[model samples]
Target: MENDGSAIALEAHELTKIYRMGAVEVHALRGVDVEFSEGELIVLLGPSGSGKSTLLNILGGLDTPTGGTVTFRGQLLRMDSERALNLYRRDHVGFVFQFYNLIPSLTARENVSLVTEIARNPMSPDEALSIVGLGDRIDHFPAQLSGGEQQRVAIARAIAKRPDLLLCDEPTGALDSKTGVLVLEAILKINRELGTTTALITHNAVIAEIANRVLYFADGRIVETRQNAVQRAPGELAW
Candidate 1:
């Protein structure tokens, strides 16, 4: 699908997710509505259980919502089947999470190559690693790399497919402040340089300063949305 000049990358309307446990139904998302523009970086901030991760998963096609709709480039998401969702995810989305999820036995280059091999059109493993500042360590195994480096490799593996959207869920949750900053910097760089529509879930409010837009979630809803007049670089953020 061709995006119009205004270029809305993704849209979600009245999104709701519920989990059933015996007789209890727990609401994870309740009537959430949001939009992500092309090349824009968004930060989702909220306390635990506020639905930030739930929204991200829905947007990434990893989870189906109980109600409402989601669209990408004006195409309605086929959430009715896992096969369709998996195809959508493979074609359009990349994901990063708190855990690196790297294969311990594979070299960093090999790890990234795994995704590129299946992608319709993908960059070389070295090229993807280079974007995240791991050009020199592409051959290093995950076991030999630091936590920060492993995370960067994960980022590289995600983006190597040249996905249109990148969804990150607490990607820096496992790192120290200094190392977290590096990971954030890599994400910022990817969004800016690759023109990837990026949405990141972070508990650190300070990290919101690095985004084009900030969304605050509470009680399974987006309580507030703010446009950052002046976006800060990842290095400029206090945490």
Candidate 2:
């Protein structure tokens, strides 16, 4: 509801994605059109097969659309070129998934260091971990952390690159409500402090209160979009 004209972070026009299996065609996205403003926090709610994941993949350059166009900062995404997509993903996007894909042997700092080492401009692993409220736990390995802390480590890894866009696919899916809220607080902090455009997908509608806007997806399309005039903190959400 509130757009301060910070510039458009991402735009998708009539985007469609189709998957084929034998004679069956699964339409993942149906000409979806959406925009994510810079520094905005948007939440996506949907059932399974609702196409939110497909949209996220396309936006992050992890997948291409079957038709239409998607762009970042007004630059058309060369979805057809793997090299271009790779560069775009590496330089601009950050992703956090349901699972914490941290290396078992690496400490939290070391896990975050993986991305900072390769990024063009990145914050130190210590700073990244601090942003996620894990500074004191930097010496702990993945095996020593709890589910939510591990997820924060994953978030630290993603944002250490100072990515302009953050795409989260069920980042709290594995944790309980309390733990999930902690993870969300970390996300909220990043979006606010870093001015990162964020898009989050989740099945739990309660989490929607924490977003600036909410998009409901059904049958491969966004059926409703709602704006939160006053955003709620993650701690305020019970489920």
Candidate 3:
């Protein structure tokens, strides 16, 4: 792996995460080492119980590794103070999940505004919505939108904070292939226009073509890493 600190956005070294379930020990991660650069889109591919989400969670500061180091832009995160982690998560990391966790009663604008209200420097909800091609549907409720539109709203909410990184775990899992492609396009646009570093975790191997780098996991270990010479757009993806 290239070790030039200047270009790296996130780095993890020998990361290991273990969970104790009474008398049983669950090793969720085993000596994983990886680095992601700014403005790069990376896909994490794995099977169930493969620790793909575990790695993404750790990278986003949502969870701490049992034994390892995670650094963001040269700032050591594994041992950071709780307050520091909180600030890091709030200010720099954007997360999108398989489910659109939007407030059911809130309009799309309001949902995006919720995060901007607490951010140190945030884009206006309208601006964020426009970026996701939701400008005209800003006042629509979650129930009024299609699955793809709802996911775009969720994406707008996540990026409203102008975060340096976006962590998505199965972002398109809830949508059909056509709708999922739209959601993926929004993600791709965010990375292109906003220059946000992105990590997407998905079971679909086909999604890897849309990423600049791809990581494959199995049995709680990183089994392979491949860099794409050319990334394809969502519509160009094979699957």
Q: Which prediction has the highest TM-score against the true structure?
A: 2
Comparing candidate 2 with candidate 3, which one achieves the higher lDDT? Answer: 2
> TM-score per candidate, in order?
0.97, 0.98, 0.96
Instruction: Report the poorest 10 consecutive residues by lDDT, candidate 1.
Output: 1-10
Residue 225 accuracy (lDDT) in model 1: 88
Off by over 4 Å in 3: 3-6, 78-80
Question: Could you tell me which residue pairs clash in candidate 2?
Answer: none
Please tell me which predicted candidate would have the highest lDDT against the true structure: 2
**lDDT (Cα, tens digit) per residue for candidate 1, span 157-189:** 999999999999999999988899999999999
Better of 1 and 2 by TM-score: 2
What value of lDDT does candidate 2 attain over all alpha carbons? 0.94
Off by over 4 Å in 1: 1-5
Which sections of candidate 2 miss by over 4 Å?
Answer: 1-4
Report every candidate's CA lDDT: 0.93, 0.94, 0.92
Ranked by lDDT, top first:
2, 1, 3
Candidate 1: pairs in clash: none
Q: For candidate 2, write residues 1-239 as lDDT tens digits.
A: 23556688899999999999999999999989999998999999999889999999999999999998998998999988999999999999999999999999889999999999899999999999999999899999999999999999999999999999999999999999999999999999999999999999999999999999999999999999998989999888885
